[model samples]
Target: MKFMHISDLHLGKRVNEFSMLEDQKDILRKILKIADEEKPQALLIAGDVYDKSIPTVEAIQLFDDFLCELSKRKVQTFIISGNHDSAERMAFGGRLMKESGVYVAPVYAGKTQAVVLEDEWGSINIYLLPFVKPANVKRFFEDEQIENYTDAIRVAVEQMKLNTDERNVLVTHQFVTGAKRSESEDISVGGTDNVDASVFDEFDYVALGHIHGPQKIGRETVRYCGTPLKYSFSEIHHKKSVTIVEMKEKGNVEISTKELAPLRDWCEMKGTYMELTEKAYYENLDQDSYMHITLIDEEDIPEAVRKLQVIYPNLMKLDYDNQRTRGKAAFLEAAEVEEKTPFDIFEELYEKQNNQEMNEEQKKLIHDLVEKIWEGGH
Candidate 1:
């Protein structure tokens, strides 16, 4: 069976306060076109269908149209709510929609049931597991020890009662440990919401969401299709695409990606104010495309944004990178921040503020407090 895997559409999203409605509309149209060419039997939208739990009216209509079009084409779409979505809202009308092959995961009330599809290989069980926290899962299993995200997921999977004889595909939304994150994704503070890849051992293919970069975790069958469009400057270099998955049998899964071409590409240009404004440098480029212009002039320009608007009207960001700006102390790199826990960062901040490392008593207090907070999350 062939399926198109995509996630984090983030419809109705705003990048640097600029609405992405038109871009989103256009991208969805393109995805529909791709679906036609690929002729996939199913489309897996892992999560984050909307940017907010309560989306704008226009955003809702946009998705409705997309779904209506998909239904018309007789393509099965499977969607799950992400952290940004309200589970109950996403679950609404799910039963009615299931009749049309639009399977929306219900607000996970304990166990996840499978939507079985048959092909030449026999049966493929598609399981929908929405974005779940430890706190959410612990309620259903009081006797189970679900203290962390890993524990929560393990317990949830345990309840699924997966059959080892058949092919299984799990569509879930969560931050699996070791996935590279882009600034666009936003994050869960304190590092308490990470699931281990080992918990998904039973499934033949795991279609994941949350992380903005398309990647395979541990094995190619376990993957994230990533966002269909770039949502932040940090994602400037991402070659966004739709992942196509082909499952042949119980033990065979193949993955490939088809790159998406957005309506307007993201661009970042850097040069001295005068050089950037030069006619020769600006004429050939697609000035209307969303862009970040970095002016390296030693002194700030008077009305630079206003002036640059004449050349690149869609300037999303403007800043300097001159001697004065470069003189400032550097902050921790994203890699460094990812390596340190929130508590570690907090302790470092305390020591820097007070000019001394935390004493043993303070350390113990902080440790206990962190532990309590982590438990409360579950």
Candidate 2:
């Protein structure tokens, strides 16, 4: 049996406040092209089918249209809910979609409820463990003590093993081993949100998500299918791809990855004002590509952005380099506001003001009044 696995689609996601729907659509079209060529038995979307809890009408239409095409081709699709997805919304009409070989696992109503798929080789049970909190699962199993995300996934995997045969795969939306998170990722409480790859030891293979980079965890059996399009400028170096797994009857699998080039590129540049405007720095500025610009100007250059925009009109940022500025000493000194308290500054200001405007008698009265207040603290 052969299949394609990918995750963190984050469809309908915006980049730099710009709609990335066209880029996402292009990538999905490429994925469909790959599917057409390979004709895989199954297509697994691990999680994050949408970018938000409530997706837009266009997002819904795009996903629906994609699924309808897959259904027409008799392709079996398995999807789960990610941290960004609303489970109830994703599961809407899930029962009816199952008839078309599209399965969406969102609710945790029971342990035995999993999507099972098959091919000429044998049956493959897929346990779709969506993003779930420990507290929510605790209500389902009152006697079970769950502590974190790791614990929650362990319980789900254990339940799946109880109901399925040996030839089983775990499709989950979670932070796991071998995943490299970008700066844009929201770090969870205490930074202990990720589950170890070893947690899925019982399953034949693990299709993971949440991280935007494709990687192999602990072993080749556990993998992450990165997002088709780059989510942030921090992900400029990432090579987005999908994992193709070929499974044999003996429970052995061969894996190969195919890269998915995005419709637009994300480019970043750092240079002084003159260098930035030079032909060497931005010779190939694609107006279509998203950009982040860091300016290394010694001083605030007038109309620096206007000048640069003439060359790279899509520039997203312009950062000043304080170190190179002539008045940096004053800038640094102005930033040391925490070293002294308000009372210290108030006393200094009183002396300065008295010296500038008050007579000796007035100064004496002010000193005496402040002295009495200071003595109260003693």
Scored by TM-score, the top model is 1
- Give every collision pair in model 1: none
Best by lDDT: 1
Candidate 2, residue 338: Cα displacement in angstroms equals: 6.5
**Local distance difference test, each candidate:** 0.91, 0.78
Per-model RMSD to reference: 6.7, 11.7
The C-alpha TM-scores of every prediction are 0.87, 0.82
**Clash pairs of candidate 2?**
none
lDDT of 1 by residue, 6-48 (tens): 9998888888889999999999999999999999999999999
